[model samples]
Target: MSRVYLSLGSNINPKHNIREGIATLNLRFGQMQLSPIIESEPVGFIGDPFINLITTLETELPISELSSQLRLIEYDFGREDNAPKFSGRTLDIDIVLVDQLEGEHFGLTLPRKDLFEHGYMLYPLSLMEPELIPPGQEKTVQELWQQFPFPEQKLWLTEL
Candidate 1:
């Protein structure tokens, strides 16, 4: 089995959608390691705040098939294929890392670029796997979190 990390976020009906998303993932993947749910301001567009979190699961499926399944899950939750990149979403799921695999596989970038650029991605990942060294990177997740610029983008754990 390959260990896969995924980032999930939702702005529209976030509390409900996020919970539903997780439940769906759990049903499909059997079990998952979930980070604390957090709330953050929308990054690229004007919209409601988003509830975000990261999850890790073990899967026997290949990256291509896994990515395809995730997209289908997002669609089932009302994600629009043509929606603007920065717009609000019902559910947004991205493959952040898949074991030690690197570069692009199935058109998806491993160790997603957002992991370095967004606190929403890095913080939760660090929480889940502090010692994890992403593919092609020497720094551990904890190191990246420590180096993250504070006060740049605000995010807080949510009770929801």
Candidate 2:
């Protein structure tokens, strides 16, 4: 089984969506390691705050199949394909890392760029898997997080 890490976020009805999203993932992938939910302002657009978290699961499925499954989950929760790139979301789930594999798999980049670009993504990941070494990177997630400008991005842990 490959260890897969995913990032989930929601702005609209975040509490409900996040709970349902987690439940769905658990049902599909069995038990998962979850990070504390964190609330952060939307990036690249003006919208409501988003609740974000990272989850780790073990799956035997290939990246293509796993990605397809996640898209279905987001769609079931009311995600719109036509929505603007940085617009509000009912539920957003993205693959972050799949083991220590690098390069493109299933047409998606391993170790997503957002892993380092956004505090909302990096912080929760570091909390869950501090020693995780992202693909093609030498530093652990915790180490990268240490250099993150937390103050520059407004985010706080939520009670979800």
Off by over 4 Å in 1: none
The TM-score that candidate 1 achieves is: 0.96
Tell me the TM-score of model 2. 0.96
Alpha carbon lDDT at 128, candidate 1: 79
1-160: candidate 1 lDDT, tens digit per residue? 9999999999999999999999999999987999878899999888899999999999999998999999999999998889999899999999999988888887988779998999899988888789988888889989989988755788988856
Score every model by TM-score: 0.96, 0.96
Candidate 1 clashing pairs?
Answer: none
Off by over 4 Å in 2: 149-151
Best candidate, lDDT-wise? 2
Error of 1 at 93 (Å): 0.7
lDDT of 2 by residue, 1-160 (tens): 9999899999999999999999999999999999988999999998899999999999999899999999999999998878889999999999999988888887998789888899999999888889988888889999999988656788989967
